[model samples]
Target chain A: MVVAEFVSELRARFGIEFKDLSILDEAFTHSSYANEHRELGISDNERLEFLGDAVLELTVSDYLYRKFPNLPEGELTRMRAAIVQTKSFSSFSREAHFDKYIKLGNGEEAAGARQRNTLLEDLFEAFCGALYLDQGRAAVIKFCQQVIFPHIDAGEFRGISDFKTALQENLQQDGNADIHYEEVSITGPGNARQFNIDVYVDDKLLGSGSGKSKKRAEQAAAKAALVGLGVIS
Target chain B: MVVAEFVSELRARFGIEFKDLSILDEAFTHSSYANEHRELGISDNERLEFLGDAVLELTVSDYLYRKFPNLPEGELTRMRAAIVQTKSFSSFSREAHFDKYIKLGNGEEAAGARQRNTLLEDLFEAFCGALYLDQGRAAVIKFCQQVIFPHIDAGEFRGISDFKTALQENLQQDGNADIHYEEVSITGPGNARQFNIDVYVDDKLLGSGSGKSKKRAEQAAAKAALVGLGVIS
Candidate 1:
């Protein structure tokens, strides 16, 4: 799609007209595209991504602080983390159809980089950064309120596993045990491998879980163990 | 000092009157104090510290982004880290005389927690949180611009030690060399112990340094080694 059409579409979708469209354009431009089109003098969005990460963090933090006035610091941190994680941002990007606007090099596009969660997450953050620069903090906050806060209000972040930490803390009160997680098995093909992980508390298997990755499987297993121990519901 | 006197002193010092003095009061109240004075209905500063941390990060990130437009994300992150580290915040707190106003329990006060850098840093962040809540983001930014920006302008954050990482990066080009730091000697009393550390590259003593702690001494030694190798000046 042409730059003008893309910008028009963005304005329509977001319901906010950007003062500096070039900044917004740069936000969607991948490094690969910039590298490929050296004569266009297009800059990548990495810097904007860094700025936007902070902006998003602060916006979410402010919301969380006000929304949960009585919540403790550690729980607040966990909630913020859940909302800001790559998976959550990727989901947001997918929902917003950010992939349709992202500009990439031929090679990257052929490699399906547009569909990649990490890239999508970075693009979303960069878009936020551009929005912040083009508008202001209030605009950024409003954007987050529209796109991000609904998820928080729905308690979408509640299921995020900090079960490992919770389990460790609970066990610590009854004297420290060597609580560890181990990948027990791997199955399926190389590209679609499923990992089975077990949570061990003092050489006893408390629970087991499976996921596409070891970390996820471990977290699932931890959650299971926490549930079994009646530490969490 | 009385709460009203303290509030008046804060107003005099900051030149900004808070609409809600209780929020500011909570910022200065340590958990220890609140735990001991349960009848006073005082809240601790931990939640404020958490909120203030995000505010400070966003403020610094925004400043860095605008100030050094050409800087890469990695460099921006490093610069932000330099400015926002606990040590830097503690310095800011000390310069602002935050230690004088902070409330502590008898036990914590007796143990000299008032002079602790970590506590001071937390207090400074809590103060920022209070200011943010009492005023707004603009007030927090203004406070940071007045107090924190001066340090950035003065290049106080430039010498923050990342020598170990730099040394490792430099060594990585010539294949991996076993680089390690070993504490050679400890001297002085418990409260003021000095550590002597030597940085070794492939079991060869490249440089040595002394400091108040092992980590500091190691960093100093790593810096010396980097200078010796002409990797950094």
Candidate 2:
């Protein structure tokens, strides 16, 4: 679509009337296209992607911080990472129809770069970066509220690593003196070692698991305990 | 320091008189102490660390995005990593007297956990997290301005992997069109192979380097080119 269509669609979709559309132009412009048309002096979206990445992170972090007050740091960290990964952003890009406006070099267009997940992720971030530049932090947050938060609030991105925290909150022990994780065994080669851990309460093993690392093992065990306790299905 | 002393000193130092001093109390309380005195019903600072870490990152990222408008994402990532690492936060904690306020269990205190770099880092983050909760986003940003930004502005965190972007910006060419990096050779075992790279500008070899990976080699070459061009000493 044309720039006017792009501007109108953005307004209709996000209520954002960008002051400087040139930043969005840069956002939609890919490195491949920019390289092919260097004479036009159009810059790529990589820088915007960089800045937009941080913007996205902060937005998501703030959302998670406020939304899930009881979740432990480990769970929040995992959720944030998952929310910002290529899959999530790419999906967000597709939903926002940002995929329709990306400018690609002739070769890249033929090579199917238009439908790539990583590219879409970059576009989403670049778009956010441009939005941040055109508007500010509030604009970005509002945009997320419209575009991203619904998915989050509907319980779409739940159940990654908060199991340990869930188990603790279920048992009313705060990952401290009340809860105990015992290392049952160490197995496998040094480089690829696996740890078996058991989560205990009142000196009874409530859950057990083995994983590639101690932390992972502990988390898995906690998840099992949570399930055994019927805290979550 | 006692809570009252901590309160008075914080106001005197940061011009911040928190409405909820309990937040700061939680920030200063370590898990060890809370674990030992379970009946006190006091929570530790881990959650605050988690939130504060994100807050610190956003604060630093916004600063960098504005301050160094020309820096590439790679350089920004490296610089951000350095600034948020244990050493920097530990030093910040010590300087801000956060180290003096930590409430550790007797064993941890006896084992010198008070001076441990990791502990100090957590304290710094927890402190920021507490400050953020007590104040809000603007307060956190302002707190960073008083605490972190000046050190950043002093040119203390330089000589990171921005050489390629620096070289290109110095040459007034963006990353895509004007600059090129060619792989000269690869040697050593599969896991430990080294790459030799050469960077060119206007068909002239400006710099060359060898590194464990292609990106590193390119960055080294860029640094060399920047030095050869006398852009940065």
Q: What is the lDDT of candidate 1?
A: 0.81
Q: Check candidate 1 and list the clashing pairs.
A: none
Model 2 is docked with a DockQ of 0.24
**Model 2 global lDDT (CA atoms, 0 to 1):** 0.81
DockQ of each: 0.25, 0.24
Per-residue lDDT of model 2, residues A1-233, tens digit only: 23788889988988989888788899999877865664585768877887888888878888988887756677788788878899999999999999999999887899899999999999999999989888988999999999889988876777646666667767875445478889888888643567799999879889998876555677889989988888766
Which segments of model 1 are wrong by more than 4 Å? A160-233, B1-5, B159-232
lDDT of 2 by residue, B1-233 (tens): 24788888888998888787788888888877765564575778887888888778878887887887656666777788879899999998988888888999887899899999999999998888888777877898888888888888775675645676567667875445467888898787643567798999877999999876455678888888888888767
